[model samples]
Target: MTDCDFLVVGHGLAGATLAYVLRQRGYRVLVFDPGQADSASNVAAGLINPVAGKRFALTWNANELLPAAASFYRELEQCFGQQFFFEAPIFKIFGSLDEQSALLTRSPDHPWGDYVASLATTDPGLPGVQAPLGGAWLRHGGHVLVRELLAALAAQGEREGWLWRETFDWTKLVTDPTGARYAGRVQARHVICCEGAAATQNPYFNWLPLTPNQGEVLDVECAGLSSAQVLNRGAYVVPVGGGRFRVGATYRWPPFADGPTETARQELSGRLAAITEQPFAVVGQRAGVRPAVRDRKPLLGPHPTVPSLSFGGGYGSKGVLLAPRLAGLLADWLEGKAELWPEVDLRRYAALYRPAAGS
Candidate 1:
């Protein structure tokens, strides 16, 4: 039988990070990654902004999550010998007078004090971007090349005899009090499902709420536009150097079309126009679905019934920030070195698995 300490399903950021940490800690790991078509992490912009959205509220756990994620990626860059982690500032352009006024009230003494690096009322002067109202420089905000990093991690796992390329069939997953045996060939002490949005298909953990967020992005080349920082308004324009940029992301539910749609393209084009006054051409466009959790936090821990099974997914757009620290925590918990964080623990959803209160 193909044996290992853990059997991790799915290789998206969540699973990948967990596998990486487990491997580092001297645990044997075997990963089953089908490399599905709509893998959201592959198309993600990987933006790690501590504060986001129109309200400019700080992410739930930004203070501790951001620095931990950054440290992981920085070390990953050195380990992989690639320049995938880019630590740069994100310029959040103020949309109107209301937004500027709100930010003005959010001085250094506010709850968001430490996250705000600097606030400016002067024009940013990004060539293609229009900046009449100016913006704020969010310190330590940056993007990671998620697709490339996953590839590098997979290659390393392969060399270490832990990477497998195949889709897991749930019917073949045989479990008992001790562990699980899959496909009649693989055995492990525990099986963790990090399927991202695709966990909805898992017969065991599909009960957890995992709403799909369809997003579309564009890859365009603009010769004259110059900028190093990520621009966020309603949409974001990330400079990929060589006069090319990655832009456009529309969120929708029950995603009608599996691929890019003309409607989203027009919407993004409108956002581009609103962000920039200069002329630019859209070169390419792609779309993927994010697993936006119902509670706006990751779904972590084991199945209520199956001792050998657990889950780690539902990161949504904040995977870049949430994955690293959570991965370590999951590894520690799985190895019996620590307890699962209460907030993300699957036990919170215990009511769902129970029958009606009086019944």
Candidate 2:
């Protein structure tokens, strides 16, 4: 049985990024992934929008996380010998004068205001496709080629003897006083679960408040679309490299078992058409569950009772923006070098459920 210092489950952005971070720290790591479950990271357009939506509120913790993510991805590029991050400005088009007024109104108090450039009074190059009442540019925001990055990391991990492509069977797991064992076989110093929404299935953390939401995105061919800038009107049109754009993200609370449905497709298409006059062909449709929490904060840190098990998830739609920082934070915490964020530390929640110390 192969033994390592660490074993991570799942290879989505969460797991993959964490594995990369741990490996960089000189930890002997083995990453296992089934590669079957629907992962939000795979289908994500990987947008990093500091300023977003009609309200245009800065994404939670954008100030602290954005720069950290940028630096992390750059270093990863150098390590992996590949580029997956692009610094692109988002074009937020105003559907009405009220929208423009809203942006101007909030620009001052909003922490992301300095990133927002002056509005363009005239419609730009994609006029045939979209009309602009005026739009602002968000600086220091861009997109990450999520799948490419994951694949690159996976490849690098493989070359470094750190990745295993297989489903993790919980039934085969065994634990003793010394350490935890997977399948009563491979032993590790610790096991960290990065299973995304699947973390809800783990018996230990299953009790954690998880409000998984289903989101869908349509990959369309936008041959003539100009610039890689993500277009924001009703739904976002994010460039996916190679002249393709991912337009979507329909949020369904209950979730559907059948995955993508005709109703959702029509709804997304209709929204895209409303935002742009251009005729685009739908080349692909993808759906996955966002591993969100009610408070919308990440869940990280070691297990409460299990000394050798750790967890890091709850990134939801912002996995691309949140994973790198959280990965570094997790690594630091594991190494006894840093403290976990109180907001994300699972111990904060455990205290409410589990009995108080010495009580």
Q: Which candidate is the best by TM-score?
A: 1
Clashing pairs in 1: none
What's each prediction's TM-score? 0.95, 0.92
Predicted candidate 2 versus true structure: per-residue lDDT over 1-359, tens digit per residue: 88888899989988888888888779888999866545788878888888876677778787788999999889978887888888988888778888778767766675574667666655765644565566776788888888788878777777767787788886677765556888756999888889888887886677677788888889888677755577877788888778788887888887465677677789889888876776789998988988998798989987777788888999888899999999999999988999998999987778545533563
Query: Could you give candidate 1's per-residue lDDT for residues 108-212 as a string of tens digits?
Result: 457675777788787867777787888888887888888899989888877877888888898799999899999889989999999888888888877888887
Which runs of model 1 end up more than 4 angstroms from their true locations? 354-359
RMSD (CA, Å), candidate 1 to true, equals 2.5
Q: Pick the candidate with the highest lDDT.
A: 1
The C-alpha lDDT values of all candidates are 0.85, 0.81
- Model 2, residue 201: distance off in Å is 1.2
Candidate 2: where are CA atoms >4 Å away? 120-126, 176-178, 351-359
